[model samples]
Target: MLNIGVLVSGGGTNLQALIDAQKSGIIHSGRIVTVVSNKPGVYALTRAENAGIDAHVITKKECGSSDAFDAALCAYLQKMQVDVVVLAGFLAILGDSFLLVYKDRILNVHPSLIPSFCGDGFYGLKVHRAALDYGVKVTGATVHFVNEITDGGKIILQKAVDVLEEDTPETLQKRVMEEAEWKILPEAVELVCSGKVHV
Candidate 1:
């Protein structure tokens, strides 16, 4: 079974989807060994705790530098023998040391179709707002291999949702998230677990 570590920074809706998929036998061959977060008091940690999974808060404030934080995070994942790292709303940009160590084993879920509304300072509601403002006809989500450059990874899977003429950012995000993230994230994680994903 693939032992996975999920990293999250907020509500962790995607993380919840992974847990649900595993429980429902859609993903029968893997387990979430740990859930790590950089922020404190996130509901994601609470969800992990309720599920009885090992959860950790590795706040950036506690570490001296990004390198040090990555080192500590890597050490923890190694201790858990994590086979894969899933970024579920994790906002921190991972350092090169962490990427080098994990390499092809790390995956990320982006809220928008990448190479468009993704990069520095683009995340969460901001991405959805951008898509709406730009009057794009279609915007969706992407699941990709994690690399050092922000969202600059090989795409594993993508699902598109139409940007309706009457859609506000919140409305568009809700619709896209339902069709894109709710399906794509778990599917991508399953692909990784089943060894179907290649770098």
Candidate 2:
């Protein structure tokens, strides 16, 4: 089975979805080996622990520089024999060394469709706000391979949601997240694990 290492910086709702998918046999060829968080006190760690997965925090303060943190993260993944690294709301921009080592093995779920409302400073609610401001009739999520550039990876999957007439950032986010992210994230992971996706 493919062993996955999940990285998160927030509530881990997507992580939970992966766990649920694994249990429900939707994702049959892989299992989450460990969960790593850059911040302490994130509920993602608790979610990992509750699922009996090994979970730990590797704070930025612990590793003085981005290079140092990447080194540590690489070492940890090596030790765990992780086959894939899944970024679930992980905020840090990874160093080149990490990208080189993991390459196509790292995957991320972005809140917006690629080549549109993506790039640095576009994440979480910010993405939703951008979609609303742009007055786009349709906006959704993208699951892609992770590279050096933020959200610049090759798109593996995408699901679109309509931007309604009375949509606020929060409401749009809620709808899109439910209709797309909740399904696509886990499905993307499964595709990677099953050898169906190539970079």
Best-matching candidate per lDDT: 2
TM-score of 1: 0.97
Instruction: Report lDDT per candidate.
Output: 0.90, 0.91
| Candidate maximizing TM-score | 2
Summarize candidate 1's per-residue lDDT along 158-179 as a digit string, tens digits: 9999888889878987887789
What stretches of model 2 exceed 4 Å from their correct place?
Answer: none
User: Against the true structure, what is each candidate's TM-score?
Assistant: 0.97, 0.98
Cα lDDT tens digits for candidate 2, 32-114: 99999999999999999999999988877899988899999999988999989999989998999999999899999988888
Please list the residue runs of candidate 1 whose C-alpha ends up more than 4 Å from where it truly belongs after superposition. none
Per-residue error for 161 in candidate 2, Å, reads 0.8
